[model samples]
Target: MPDAQKMFERITLPRDAGLPVSLCNVSKTYRTGFGLPVHALNLVSLRVPSGQALAITGPSGSGKSTLLHLVGAMDTPDEGSITVGELELARLQERERAAFRSQIGFVFQRFHLLPALTALDNVAAPLLPLKVGFDKQQRARELLAAVGLSGRERDLPSHLSGGEQQRVAIARALVNSPGLLFADEPTGDLDSRTGAKVMGALLELRSKRGLTLLIATHDAGLASRCDRVIELLDGQIVSDSEG
Candidate 1:
């Protein structure tokens, strides 16, 4: 197996490549069991520039996750269009969408690590589906170290602290060298102090990699750290402001 340094050398992004996201009158709705219709997003539209961090802040049912899902290609909007870089998400075929999604990184509120796998293994798992040319294990190890988990590569999720576990998740997200990162309430599972550490690591990595970041959170403090913030209410954008 190649060493971490050698693996790191294989991870590269084009010097001018950065994904800018755009949404145009997007909407999503769900049908309830009782035959009621619930609007998750209603004609929402926004744009995020390349290499910039944007925060989505809203109340519990304000459709923040719905917006993230559409932008991340996890779900398609019921109406309008979503564009990430040059790809129109709603217009993509299954195969093309799968290919496009592989270029994005996602971190959730829960650290969805496998309890049976070591941190290194968890990070390397995502690369198994892709045709990456480098050693996934070494790349995972390097990502772990980059997130301040240099010596904890072998630690299981249960053995690490909350902050450390989140760090591991971040490393796993970055293992594929994604140009865009989507985080949905990434710090919601931790205490304030631990959350701060995780958020700091995320921001540092974004700066280092020039990644386009979109984070959905209720934390005002965390939102304040982003380059811009958009507030949603009742599935509609209520305010959009620069930080």
Candidate 2:
């Protein structure tokens, strides 16, 4: 198997930040060659308003990650519809989908920084293949400052702490100024203190940019930090309450 860091370095899949999202009776099933097919999501319906912060809580295989993937257009549902902002996902062609994805930012548990790049360069990687109006390094610096990594721009991934590296990943994800952000266990690898700081930065940016934020997490403390929380079980929503 390939090293996770090296794989990310090679593919460099840049993701985006916020859009009001809607899904209607969406279902996704994976058919393994062996026995019963696994149902990742089943008739799941949800609507997230623009600029809202929603946390999804569930045990493993409860479809939290699947929900995010479907909503983010990283994967498609086998049934029903998904709409983000003004666009319907299933209808978008390949090129259009790529363009749409560029406008959305995503953060994951793994930092995925290129081993060869400095912090500043890592944060600016997403912008290298696109045409943007802003200066990349300046944007990266501003984001690093926001995440409290001001003096660490020249440091490589190996030289930084886990928290700082994650922050760099966050900056890279947001380089396109996406309208929606999806975080899948973003703080799963950090200690409580570091995790809190990372979540704080994310919420601050979400509020500042008016981005809709969706976080999937096992930590109740982290889930409570959002404006609303939804619990999932067996690929279905079981509870949705205010944070």
Q: Give the true-structure RMSD of model 1.
A: 4.9
Estimate, for each residue in 1-243, the C-alpha lDDT of model 2 and write its tens digit. Answer: 334333333333322335788999999998888968898898998899888899999998999999999888889899999998878889876666666776788999998899999999998888886555688889989888877789999999999989888998988888777788899999999999999999998999898766899999999998899989999998999898952
Model 2 poorest 10 in a row by lDDT:
7-16
Error of 1 at 125 (Å): 0.7
- Where model 1 places Cα greater than 4 Å from the true spot, the runs are 1-17
lDDT of 1 by residue, 56-141 (tens): 99999999999988888888888999988777777766656666666688999998999999999999998875556688888998
Number of the top-ranking candidate, with TM-score as the measure = 1
How close to the true structure is residue 6 of candidate 1, measured as C-alpha lDDT? 34
Candidate 1 whole-model C-alpha lDDT, 0 to 1: 0.85
Quote each prediction's TM-score: 0.91, 0.90
The 0-to-1 C-alpha lDDT of every candidate, in the order given, reads 0.85, 0.85
TM-score of 1: 0.91
